[model samples]
Target: MQSEKLYSDLKPLLLSLAYHTLGSVTDAEDIVQEVFLTWEEKPPQQVRDVKSYLCRSVHNRCVDFIRSSSRKREAYVGTWLPEPVNTDKFQKNDPLAEMVWKESLSTAGLLLLQQLSATERIVFLLHEVFRYRFDEIAEIVDKSTANCRQIFHRAKKGIGPLPDRNPEIIEKKAAFAERFAEALTTGNIGLLIELLSSDTVLYTDGGGKVKAALRPIKGSEKIIRYFIGIKDEIPAGTRYETSEINGMPGIRLVVGEMIFAVITFHYLRDQLSDLFVVMNPDKLSHFNRMK
Candidate 1:
C-alpha cells in the first residue's frame, strides 16, 4: 500500500520531467508507465529517497528514448520540429505546469535544446529551469558535480540569451502579427513588406510531403514576395486565422476540419524579424484543440 501510494504521488512529477526532456506528451506518458512497471517488478528494500530515485529513473528513460528517437528523426523526410503542447490542459498555478509549458512552447528554447546531447539537455534543464544543484544532477546522471556544471555551462552557451518576455512587448508583437496575417490573406504585398524588418527571415517546414520553399527566405523583399506567391496557392477549402501562439500572436491554417499549419512571429520592436511556419502534419496535431 505504501509503495502504491508513493508511485501515485510521483506520477505527475515523472510525467512533467519526461515530457520536458523528450518534448512529446505521448512518449513522456509511455516513459512514466514503464517506470512504475519497473518499480513494481523490483521494489527496492532500503530506498533512502523515493523522490530522488523516481527522478533519476524518469531522467534515464528519457535520455535513452531520445537517443533512439534521434536516429529515427534523422530519416524523417524534412525539417524535424518539436511537438506542440496544449497548455490549457494543465493547472496554471502549478510550477511543473509552468516548466512543461515553457520548455515545450518556447520556440527559440526548444530549437536550442535540439542542438544539445541528451545528457546535456537533461543536465541543463534540471539545473537551469528547476534550479537543481549540480550535485543533485550529478547523482542523477552518474557524473561528477564538476562535470555536470561544465555540461550545464556548455548548454547555456548553446542557447545564448533569450529574448525579453515583457507582456507589453509581447502584445505589441501580437498586434503586428495580426496585421501581417491580414495583409497576406488580402493580397497586400506592399503592406506586408513594410511591416517586415530589412533582414527578416522566413522558415517553413512542410516535411517534404508538401510544397514549401527548399531553403529559408532571407531579406524583407524576398520573404514578402514568397508570401505573396503562396497566398493565392492555398487550397480551395483552406482558411487562415491569427491567434496567440507560444505567448506571441501568430497564424493557423485550417483545412476542412483539421488545423494543417501554424506560423509564429518573431518581432524586433514593431518590425517583423522572423516568421516560422510549421506545416509538418505531425507537429500540428495540437492545433486541433483550438476548435
Candidate 2:
C-alpha cells in the first residue's frame, strides 16, 4: 500500500521525464508502469527522496529505450515525428502542465532533441528541462559532474537555437488556423501561398503508414502544389477542431473515427515560418484515446 501510494504520487513526474526524453506517450506510460510494478514487488524503506529515485529510474530507462529504439527508427519508413499529447488531459499540477513554457514539450523541440546522441539528450534534458544540477545528473547517468557539464554544453551548442513557442500567440494562431482551413478546404492555393512565408517549410511525419511527403516540402510554391495534389484525400466531411496541442493552439483533423493529422505552426517575422503535419498512426493513437 505504501508503495502504491508512492507510485500514484510520482506517476506524473515519471511520465513527464519519460515523455520528454522519449517523445512517445505509449512508451512513457509503459516505462512508468514498469517502474511501479518493480517497486511494488520490492518496496524500498525510508527512501530519502522518492522523486529523485523515480527520476533516476526513468532517466536510465529512457536512455536504454533510446539505444534500443534507434535501430527501429532506422527501419521505420518515411519521416518520423514525435507523438503529440493533449496537454489538457494531464492533471493541473502535472509537471507537463507546469513545464508548458519549456520548448522541450513542443513538437519542434522534440524533433530537435532527436538529433542528439542518447547520452547528450538525457544530460541536456536533465539539466535544461528538469532543472537538475550537473552533479545530480552525473549521479543519475553515472558520469562525473564535469563530464555531464561538457555533454550538456555540446548538446546545447549542437541544437543551436529553436523557433519561438510563445503562449501569447493564441489569438494569432486562431486567425491563422481559420484562414488555413478555409484556404485548404476551398482549394485556394494562391491564398494559401500568400499566407506562408517565402521560405516556409512543411514537415510531414507519415512513418510510411500512409501517404506523406518523405522529405520536407520547402518554399511556398512547392508546399502549395503538394497540398493541391493531396486535397482529395481529405475528403469533404472530415472534421477539423481547433485545440491546444503541446500547450499551443493547433488543429486536429479527424477522418471518420480516426485522427488523420495534427497540424502545428510556427511564425517568424510575422509570417508562418514552419508547418508541422503529424500523421503517424502509432503517434496519433494515444492522442485519440485521450480525446
Candidate 3:
C-alpha cells in the first residue's frame, strides 16, 4: 500500500524526467515501471528523500537506456522526431506537469538535447530544466558537486541559450500558428508562403512505415510544393484540428477518430522557421490510445 502510494505521488515527475531524457514514450514508461518494480521489491530502509531517490533511479535508468539505444537510433529510417505528447492530457495543477509545460520539452527541444552526451544531457536537464541544485544533481548523477557544476556549465554553453517563453510572445506565436493551419487546410498557397520563412525547413518522420520525405524539405517553395503534392495522399474523411503537442501549438489530422499525423511548428520572427510532421504509427500509438 505504501509502495503504491509512493508510486502514485512520484509517477508524474518520474515519467516526465524519463520521457524528456529518452524522447521515447514507450521506453520512458518501461523505465518508470521497471524502476517502480525495483522499488517495490527492495524498499529503501533509510532513504531521506523519496522524490530525489526516485528521480535518481529514473535518471540513471535513462542514461543507461540512451547508451544502449544509440546505435539503433542512428540506423532509424528517415528523420527521427521525438514522440509527441498531448500537453492537454497532463494532470492539471500538478507541479510536474507545470514543469513539463514550462520547460523546452518540445519536439525540437528534445532533438537539441539529443546532441549532448548522455551524462551532459542528464546534468543539463536536472540543473537547467528541473531546477535541481548542483549538489542534488551531483548525488543523482553520482558525481562531485564541483564536477556537476562544471558539466552543467559546459553543457549549457554547447546547447546555446534556451528558448524564450514570454507569455505575449507565446500568444503571438499561437495566433500565427492558427493562421498557418488555416492556410494549409484551405490550400491558400499565397498565405502559406507568406507565413513561412524563406529558408524554412520541414521534417517528415514516417519511420519507414509510411510514405514520407526521406530527407528534410527546405525552403518555403519546396515545403509549399510538398504539401500541395501530398493533398491527394490524405485519406478520405480525414479532418484537421488545432492541438497542443509537446507543449507547442500543433495540428492533428484525424480520420474516423484516429489521429494519423501531428504537425508541430517552430517560428522565428513570427514566421514558420521549422516544421515537424510525425506520421509514424509507433510514435503515435501512445497518443492514439489516449483518445
- Number of the predicted model whose TM-score against the real structure is largest: 3
Clashing pairs in 3: none
Candidate 1 regions with alpha-carbon error over 4 angstroms: 1-16, 40-43, 88-105, 236-239, 289-291
Q: Pairing residues by index, what is the TM-score of model 3?
A: 0.94
Q: Candidate 2: global Cα-lDDT?
A: 0.78
Task: List candidate 3 stretches off by more than 4 Å.
Answer: 91-96
lDDT of 1 by residue, 1-291 (tens): 476787666776677667667766578778899888888899789877777787898888987888788778787665555555544344354555554445333555666787788788788877876678999888888999999999999988997755565778767776787787778777787788779888988878887867787577899888877876787778777777776565456777788888877887666766888778888776666557545
For candidate 3, write residues 71-122 as lDDT tens digits. 9998999999999988756635466666555664777788888888778888
lDDT: the better of candidates 2 and 3: 3
Error of 3 at 15 (Å): 0.7
Sorted by lDDT, highest first, which candidate order results? Answer: 3, 2, 1
Q: Using Cα atoms with residue i matched to residue i, what is each candidate's TM-score against the true structure? A: 0.82, 0.88, 0.94
Query: Better model by TM-score, 2 or 3?
Result: 3
TM-score of 2: 0.88
